[model samples]
Target: MTATIDTMISRLAAWLSRHSIDVLRVSLGLVFVAFGTLKFFPGVSPAEALSVATLEKLSLGLLSGYAAQAVIAAMEVFIGLTLVTGKLLKTGLVVMTGALAGFFAPYALFFTDLFPGAPTLEAQYIFKDIVLAAAAMVIAARALGARLVPVREPLERVHELRERAAA
Candidate 1:
């Protein structure tokens, strides 16, 4: 079972390297752009978001809330553009990972009350972000030139192919 799992992992890693980076860039860019735009929308007030009162309860000032939220929105927009243009992908992915960590830290460790009645929703949302963060991290690591394990082929078949090509 362990061997089979290792083989599968190796194959998956090879597959990721073979695929084009543009696909990942587009998917991540669209997500960040939409989310950031929503933050700027009139009805999407941070003070009224599900986590707002909890933030105040923790004694965070109004200005702090506004500033932090605004910074997050702006970063998202900037990262989205970076990803879509395939420029500075490593930096964008690193920023996205850091952003995810920053978001999860407070909510996961200190603000249980903010989600007192919506455990399922809270868990689902956090989990989704975790997945996104992992994806970004993976791409960042790969783009940094980490080598994937080679795929295996039958040895006899390899020799046969070489003989045919030599003819």
Candidate 2:
């Protein structure tokens, strides 16, 4: 029974190892697209006010209000399309890095607003970006040719299995 369970677990892990990164990339892309689309409409995205404020501050008063929101929305949508389509992914990841930095800028720019004795709703929202950043890192690594090798088996054994499966 133990051997059977281990075999099943290994197979499951192998399947996940094969498909998880692509799933993550697509899911992240969808999230970006959804949020970006929301920003296209004024007063629709919950992050709109804070996002505008952050951009205005970061751009040293050069960007603000609906214009700022539109810029961010366009950037996010572009990143989403590249990630989803796997075309110009390196360019998308580059833009995503900048956007992620902007996303986290509020912690420094509006420390008090985001955290006035216990975390506010905006703080909670920004905190979730850490996960998105990490997911993006994984996708970027994969784009750079990294693979998720299962750990239960030896590297050689895993390669052998993959080779046999390919045959």
Judged by TM-score, which candidate is best?
Answer: 2
lDDT (tens digit, per residue) of candidate 2 on 1-167: 64566688789999999999999999999999999999999999999999999999999999899999999999999999988989999999999999999999999999999999999999999999999999999999999999998878755675687679999
Best by lDDT: 2
Overlapping backbone residue pairs in candidate 1 total: 0
lDDT of each: 0.64, 0.94
Candidate 1's C-alpha runs over 4 A off are: 1-16, 45-66, 114-120, 147-167
lDDT (10s digit) by residue, model 1, range 67-110: 54566667787778777777887788778876676556557554
- Count of backbone collisions in candidate 2: 0
| TM values, all candidates | 0.64, 0.87
Single out the weakest 10-residue window by summed lDDT for candidate 2: 153-162
* Candidate 2 Cα outliers beyond 4 Å, as residue runs: 152-167
lDDT of 2 at 42: 98
